[model samples]
Target: MFHTLKQVPHSIAFPASNTVESGAAKEDQAISITYDKSVTLVRINCPRQDGHDWVIEAFTALEKCGMAFDMVSIQPGEVSFTVKSRLVDSVYRSLEKLEVYPDSVTDCVKLSVRGRSGQPLLSSMITMAETLAQCNIPLLRLVESYGLIEVLIATGYISEVRKALAKNFNC
Candidate 1:
């Protein structure tokens, strides 16, 4: 009943590279992990409860495919009026895991600037991204410490990180 990560159902996940976190990240060194719900709003269908079920089906499919999401919303636009409901929303988890470096520790991302080539830098970035994903530290904690584009490929924070960046930079 689940979908592949690539075929992640639109119901369970909103396909966008939008902010997952609740607020903006202001620190300069914060690393963000925003996800790409990545799907576009393409078409519309007839209004019916079956549409609600369809959305739920998509979300359940996504879960089987290794993708998770929350806050399912269904909206029906009719010639008369619009109706909406939250069909399926995943509960927020506190995680409550132990600290990594703790709040007292400060980190930095020092990039070696080169004029023409970015391969070396990209390679280095990929490695670093893998490491960050493995850290097992809570993503919000990492972001509270560092900023977005600071951690491009953090697997765990992929959904929330990019959002933090846009909020802080106002871009």
Candidate 2:
């Protein structure tokens, strides 16, 4: 039950510059779409059944290590976060000292679509998801905040997903 963009006739036009063929080749040649291979998802579960306290403790440990993270999910007894793979060891060590053990560590890549303040967030997300789905790329996780939409996907499919997004969004 997600919103999907209805297909409009090709005659309903966008500006020449925004047309796919006109700009696709140029952009594709100029910039290569690649995923960050060094991203890892770290899942922390609090046996004490304290999601909030563990979240704070995890963030505090991350802060102490000067590592940046994206909060993935939070439940009553589990909290998952992600950090760059390079910082995993350091962050893990820091958390271990704090008595927080990661329940799982997974590798993932992030793709972000950013827009101006008034951009239609929900529509954009649906379009992006539909594009990826058409290309047979699975969206592992999704997060929307402020003016950004971040999608977590398997690293292996990132290039294909990016191409689909660019094609559909006319990026």
Candidate 3:
């Protein structure tokens, strides 16, 4: 049965039959994935009283050693970052010189998921997390920023994680 409105304020047409599918296609085009393999995650323990100082010192040491790092996370008594797997030895040596022992995970990879402009940050994050969870992927560390989510995970799961995200977001 079809019923007509008694009054119409403004004319609005319902979405086309393919609207939902088209929206998913747009999301697939708007999302992009990038990654870096052969990365190492290093975490250094510092005294709470001097954690900040230790962090600065660690940076300086890395600089002196001519090693570059990223994904640096600093907490009250801990600092973690990533460097090229090739530089793990230098990183460990440099830290040892400062009497800082750091635990590290080698054979890691960094994955970045970028969303198009105006995308909802929180929703995108939640969706990404859910996608990973559904795939049984373990996220070692996660960093979220404007329109971007970076995750560190074991290199072995890179393909699986990427496939899951691509499937979930249609990317």
Best candidate, lDDT = 3
* Local accuracy of candidate 3 as per-residue lDDT tens digits, 101-165: 89999988777655445352334556667777898888787878765677889989976875665
TM-score of each: 0.19, 0.64, 0.73
Which residue runs of candidate 3 sit more than 4 Å off their true CA positions? 1-29, 47-51, 116-122
Q: lDDT per model, in order?
A: 0.26, 0.59, 0.68
Ranking by TM-score: 3, 2, 1
Ten contiguous residues minimizing lDDT sum, candidate 1: 93-102
Give each model's clash number.
Answer: 23, 0, 0
**Cα RMSDs, all models:** 20.3, 10.3, 14.4
Candidate 1 residue lDDT tens string, 21-69: 4454322221222232221111223334544554444434444544443
Q: Where is model 2 poorest over a 10-residue stretch in terms of lDDT? A: 6-15
Tell me the deviation in Å of residue 103 in model 3: 1.2
